[model samples]
Target: MSIKNKVISTLALSGAVLAFSAAVSAQDATPSTMEKTEKVPKRGGHGDKHKMGGRRGMMHGIELSEAQKTQLKAIHEANKPSESAMSEMRELRMAKRAGTLTADQQTRFAAIKAERKSKHAAVKAQIDSILTADQKQQIETRKVEMKQKMQERRELRKQRKANQTETAKPVAG
Candidate 1:
């Protein structure tokens, strides 16, 4: 009933909303098989070995020249961190989820994630540098289109979940 308690509750609700939205819209590190079903020639759709897209896989319909592909692949390989580093990041995430990570571990994990993000950005920038003006437009258009598609999918999933919960109720005797 106090102002302090009301503020705490409001903060908690906002945090939950943000967390749910993030989980719903987070892009995949690797696109699933379903996403890779259709192959677009020249245009890097989903399964790009070169990692042309950023961490969120934004390189949807942007066509890449063979030379550009080679360059992007080289940049991607060079920017990749050690296997141990990635494994440690995974462990840190698990610790956080388990509510067992110490303050020091949280700091360390934040540093690791930031470093990873920077490396990803560097690779993406390298790829973007070689793209022509038209290519850049394609990338931007595809990103917007994909974002809308993702939002639609999330809405459908929520509706389906609600329906299932409703159907699970026992009928009146």
Candidate 2:
């Protein structure tokens, strides 16, 4: 997991998914509050994808050449699914969390994931075509660095969660 991957995963979990569910659950509340809570933030665009070669926050101090930046932008655009597919994915994710999915829904969701995975693989191939041999090797090294960072974050989160539970408990003495 690169830093970009980590950020995307975190945002999907804490931002988009949570916001939608929160809005839906609060539907019966006051109209003004509901309206404010229901607005879903727009997804990232050219700025997010092309800015710093999609590793804006992740790869500190490393900069891509003009050619590399252009190729990365093209690769990102090519890999992005259609708007309809993204909407369907969002709906399926919300439904999965809201309740048990029927057999058909489960099958459809699985197919969508497969399609997205295929697109990702194609994009990766395109990116590799643009990179120099040394850059490709550097990416592999970065993957290892990212994996270690991810594990450390997970452990830290677990410890924080445990401490919260302990503090919340009342002493029996």
Candidate 3:
């Protein structure tokens, strides 16, 4: 094969590897989930300092008093998964990635997910109680704005895909 062909093959393989890793890690980095079930980057590592899980993300753009901040921090700390649980979750994620998760491990993973869901809900309630009515309204408005932005992005992606499909068509000479 020519050198050009070999370089193309290498680039293709690298793209595939990156795509696969991103797909596998997507769930581990769910923006909506409070508990980090897997060992991923910190919540604000991507320049989204406020777009964290739990109440922090939901309360984005809403001002909080010093007391409220302290309370929410305490709630977060109190509800964090134990170190053992985090370790088990990391192991399970690895097994899942390797396609070696057994039926028992699947069951365990499901239980852990459920526990995290409940804990997230409980923490959200506590945070809600701390917020004033006006702050809640601000949060709701932000949510609506974000939803609109997401919808626009989806439409844009669809249009881009359509254009690509059109451009890829073969023209008769």
Top lDDT hit:
3
Per-residue lDDT of model 1, residues 1-173, tens digit only: 99999999999999999999899789567788977896557665555444545546655456678897787678867887899998999999999999999999999998988888888788778877988889888878877888899999999999999999999999999
Give the TM-score of each candidate: 0.63, 0.61, 0.64
Better of 1 and 2 by TM-score: 1
Local accuracy by lDDT, each model: 0.83, 0.79, 0.85
Q: Write the per-residue lDDT of candidate 3 for residues 40-159, one digit (tens) a residue.
A: 786657554542354447665567889998888888788878999999999999999999999999999999999999998998899889889998888888889889999999999999
Better of 2 and 3 by TM-score: 3
**Candidate 2 lDDT, 1-173, residue by residue in tens:** 89999998998888888899999998875568768889676776445554534554333344568888787777776666789988988998988999977889999999998987887788778878887777777777787888999999999999999999999999999
- Top TM-score prediction, candidate number: 3
Write the candidate numbers in order of decreasing TM-score.
3, 1, 2
Candidate with better lDDT, 1 vs 2: 1
User: Which candidate, 1 or 3, would have the higher lDDT against the true structure?
Assistant: 3
Q: Which stretches of candidate 2 lie over 4 Å from their true place?
A: 1-53, 57-62
CA lDDT of 8 in candidate 2?
89
lDDT of 2 at 116: 79
